[model samples]
Structures are given as C-alpha cells and as structure tokens.
Target chain A: MTDELVLRLLARLHGHAGWLAVAALLHPVIVLRSPMRRARGAAWASTLLVSAVAGLGAGLYPSYRALLKQAIFQQNPTVGWWFERKEHLAVGAVTFAWIGLLCHLAAARADSTSQKRLAALAHRAYAAAFFLALSVATIGTIAAANRSF
Target chain B: MTARSALTAASAFAIVPLAYAAQRCVEVGLGGELDPALVPPSPRIALFWRVGVSLVLAAGSTGPFYRLAERSPALALRVAEALAALAFGLLVAQAVFAP
Candidate 1:
C-alpha cells in the first residue's frame, strides 16, 4: 500500500480503537459492577476486545511514524515533539490495556473476595488506558492538522 | 490477589518502558535522526538519555504501582482515574493551544 493509504488506514483503525476504549471504560461501572454472571462475562469479553483494538493501534504507530517522518518530524520540531509524546502515551495505554485484560481474567477466576479486589483494580487500569487512548487519538488529529505535506 | 497475578501486572507495566526504550534505540541505531530543531541539540546524546530515562521510569514505577494496587485497590483506582483525567486535559491543551 502507498504511504498515504497506509496512514489513512491506520488513522481509521486508531479512531475505532479510541471509540472502543471509551466504551470499554464504561463497562467496569455499568457491566462489571453488576452481580449478575452474564454481565460480568460481557465485561470480560469487552475488555478483551478493547485491548485487542488498542494493541492493534499501538502496533501500527511505528509504521505510521516512519511513513510521516519527513512530512511531520523533519519539517518542524514542535510538531515532532507533540507526535513523539503522543506515541509514548499510546504505548502506555496499550500496555495498561493488556494488563487490564490480564487482571480481568484473573478476576473472573478468582474466589469472591479476590474477585472483588481484582475487578476494582482492573477497572482502574481500563480507565487509565482509555483516557490515554483518547489522548493519543486527539493528538494524532492535531498533528495531522499541522502536517506540511 | 495471587502472587502470580501481581507479578504478571508488574511485568506488564515494566514492559511498557522497555518497549519504548527498545524502539528509541532502534530508531536512532537504524539511522533515525532526532529533529535538530527540537531541544538538546545532540541527537545521539539525547537518544541515550531517553533510553536511560525510560529504563529508570520502568524500574521505579512497576513495583510501586503493584504495591499500590495491592494495598489499596480503591485508592489505586482513584489515583489512576485522576491521572487519566489530568493526562487528557494536558493533551487537549497542548493540541488546541500549544505553539
């Protein structure tokens, strides 16, 4: 694929991932908070899906950066700083999402007391990850606005 | 709750900085230049410094975060949520207003 096409695809993926992250953030409160087995199961499934999407977006970032090196990084320093910082934040988000997934799994298998604790922590991690993902997406949009080419 | 799960969470957090460090090293080692227009002025030195910083951050944060979660899950969750909100605000400001 052409560089432009690839960038566009990645951007779209990032956008969708950001939206999913937002949805996933609410699951801890809406779904996981429930005492019902079915709700907890749905929460677990949503966690996995959100993590996968966030991971995919994070994975594609390097390629996007490499492609835009000249147009974004080399052309201006301020924009480069913003983009680099955004990338770092995205990495944190991706890592947290994975960790959150693991925590969710552990929670599902835990006994009642442990399950309660793990679920709480997992929800927090998910919140952090979602916010970071949102930041990354917003920064990407801003960076694109500043692109020279 | 289990030792194994705690270890896994800590490891996961640690990997973030390691991955970032590796990416920065490769970017520089593979002929990626730090934009001279940015601060520090020396790309090679800046690259090494960044990698070192990342390593230090990973080492410093992983254990503390794990402990925090273990000791006070509620507090940990509150802190994480607050930080996330702060991060969001900062990024939005930077994007919308920063020169």
Candidate 2:
C-alpha cells in the first residue's frame, strides 16, 4: 500500500509538472512573438521544466509498468500505443525546446542580421515545442484515464 | 541566416534523431535485446539517457560548430547540414523499416 501510494503521488506530481511545462514552453513562444526579444528566463524555465518532467516520468515508469501496463492494454490496446506515441512526441518536445533555447542564446550575441534570423528560428522552435508539449500532456491524461497507478 | 545560424539550426535539429538514437543504444546494446532491428521500445527507454543526454550532446556540439563556423563558415555549414541530414535519415529509416 505504501509503495502504491508513493507511486500514485509521484504520478500526480508528474502530471502537474507536465502541465506546468506546457505553460512554460508557451512562454517563450509568446515572448518571442512580441517586440521584446527576452528569452533567457522563460526559455530556460521551459527547457528545464520539460526535461525534469520527462525525468520524473522516467522515475515512475518502472512502477507504471509493474502496476498498470497490463491493465491498460487489457482495457484498451490502442491506448497503450498512444502512450508510446506520447513518449515519442515528448522527445520531439524536448528537442524543440532545446533548439529554441540554443538559438535564443546565440541570437543575443550575433550580428543584427544573424540575430534576426536566429530569433526567428527560436520563435518557430518554441512554437513547435509548445504544440508538442501540449499534445503530450493531452495524451498522457488520456493514457492515465484508461489505467493509472 | 549566417553560417553560424545554419550550424545552430542543424545542431538543434539533431536533437530529435540523437535522442531516438540514445534510446536505441541502451535498449538494444545494453538491455540484452540485441535484435539488430529497429523497433519501437517495449515500454519506452529511460528518458534520462534518451532525452537528457541527447540534449546535452546536441547543445554541447553547437559550441564547437560555432567556433568552426567562425573560421570557415561555409565548411561548418556543410558539415553541420550533412551531419544533421545523416542523423535525420537514420532516424527515419529506423522508424519506417522497423521489423
């Protein structure tokens, strides 16, 4: 019971962090779209949050497999694959956010022409990150709804 | 975009393929699942090595790419693009032709 409770709590925290990460990822998208070129704070926050949230999910995976994987597949086979797809998309999310961050940092130091191009790339990258992160959160919720630890 | 920006874009894009490659690494090489065929993971690979390490390597590689771009922007651009293309191709091949 204690172990179950711990896994449950960790799962809840992971879900919450995933949502927070989605929001954080959006921050860079919005900030970059605006006249303000500031990206360090929000960009860093999003990248760190997404990476940590992904890490937390990793921490919970063993428990999830032991406790819930079979039940989830039994209940709905497709949801199981959706869960896998979620993981794949999460990889994309992390990459997009990292890409955005790298570009934003480089944009600050480059010449004006390069800066403009880098910043534009950052904006697009963050937007893609935000979209993928949101998709992951949604898929996660659906997966958990089917069966959760 | 300048050569440096080209390198940045290519390096950044490398993250996806790199992360997927990392997951494949531990799953196939170390987990005793040496099937030698690209397939979706059983329950997904550990994100630490998959995502975290890829993020670090892709991000770190950019620094060298930037310096190289400084000396030979055109060469750096070509190398970065080629590497990124290669990685992307490997990722696609794996995804599409999984046994």
Strongest candidate by TM-score = 2
- Per-residue CA lDDT of candidate 2, range B15-72, in tens? 5555675465445455533221233335654544466667667777777777787786
Instruction: After superposing candidate 2 on the true structure, give the runs of residues whose Cα lies further than 4 Å from its correct spot.
Output: A34-36, B1-13, B16-67, B72-99
After the best TM-score superposition of candidate 2, give how far the Cα of residue B97 lies from its true spot, in angstroms.
11
Q: TM-score (0 to 1) for chain A, all models?
A: 0.70, 0.93
Q: DockQ for all models, in order?
A: 0.15, 0.17
TM-score of the second chain, cand. 1: 0.46
Worst 10 residues of 2 chain A by lDDT: A109-118
Candidate 1 per-residue lDDT, tens place, A1-149, comes to 88677667766776666666657656654554443233445455555666676566656655554455445545776777777667656655665665565556666665576566566656665666667667776776677777622
Q: TM-scores for all candidates?
A: 0.57, 0.72
CAPRI tier for the interface of model 1: incorrect
